[model samples]
Target: MLRLLKVLILLPITAILVVFAVSNRQSAVVSLWPLPYEIATPVFFLVLAPLILGVLLGGAAAWLAGGKSRRLARERARQIRTLEKAATTLPAVLS
Candidate 1:
């Protein structure tokens, strides 16, 4: 089921990407100032490279931001386990 869902989602996206790449086959020049370096590549590459890089960097930023919450959760889980152990060793209170 999961496989089918992924195929359904990915197939169209793959087709679109293929069409986009084919349509944007014209060469584009990329250069950086303060450096003597330049390369000619596909137009689609110029657009897609930054987009993919932004996605990776954004994901990393979000993961880093969540570290404090994850750490607190782990601390809470440890405290709960400790309390459970201590409770098991304690005498039961009468109702």
Candidate 2:
């Protein structure tokens, strides 16, 4: 099911990229940023920018989520350990 969704998504993306590549074969100077870095070939940016941004954003989001998940797991484990220690000592204290 997941694979089917991935294939469906990629089909349109592949088509769009093919069209973008065909349309942007010419070398056009793109000065959208504060610091203008020239792309000798427009096709490179057309294909690469989104891929790079996707990877960067995915990595950042994953890193943030991973930290939170790790923290939560550690806290849960700590609570469990404390509870177990208390349970082991309760009979000794009562006696």
Candidate 3:
């Protein structure tokens, strides 16, 4: 199911990239170096910059969040086990 969803989401992006790559012969007006520049629209960063930055940011955030949650879960499980052991031993010790 996730694979299908991934394909569906990526299909349009793949199509757009292919279209841009193939249609790069024409130029468009763009800004560069503190001025509006005329460059090949499909050949420019408009086709790549955001994708790169988004991937980097998304990867970093996922890593950071996943690490924290995994650590918290481990700590919670350890605490639960410690409490259970203490509870089980206390009755025998008191008797």
Q: Write one digit per residue (lDDT tens) for candidate 3, span 29-73.
A: 576767666555645457577888999999999999799789999
Tens digit per residue, CA lDDT, model 2, 1-95: 99999999999988987787777777766665777675465765766788979989999999997998899999999999999999999999999
* Pairwise TM-score winner, candidates 1 and 3: 1
| TM-score comparison, 1 vs 2, better candidate | 1
Candidate 3 local distance difference test against the native: 0.82
Badly placed stretches (over 4 Å) of model 3 are 25-42, 76-95
| Superior candidate under TM-score, 2 versus 3 | 3
> Which candidate achieves the best lDDT against the true structure?
1
TM-score of 1: 0.70
Could you tell me which 10 consecutive residues in candidate 2 have the lowest summed lDDT?
38-47
| Candidate 3 or 2, higher lDDT | 2
Scored by TM-score, the top model is 1
Cα deviation in Å at residue 16, candidate 2? 0.9
Cα-lDDT of candidate 2: 0.85
TM-score for candidate 2, residues paired by index: 0.49
lDDT of each: 0.91, 0.85, 0.82
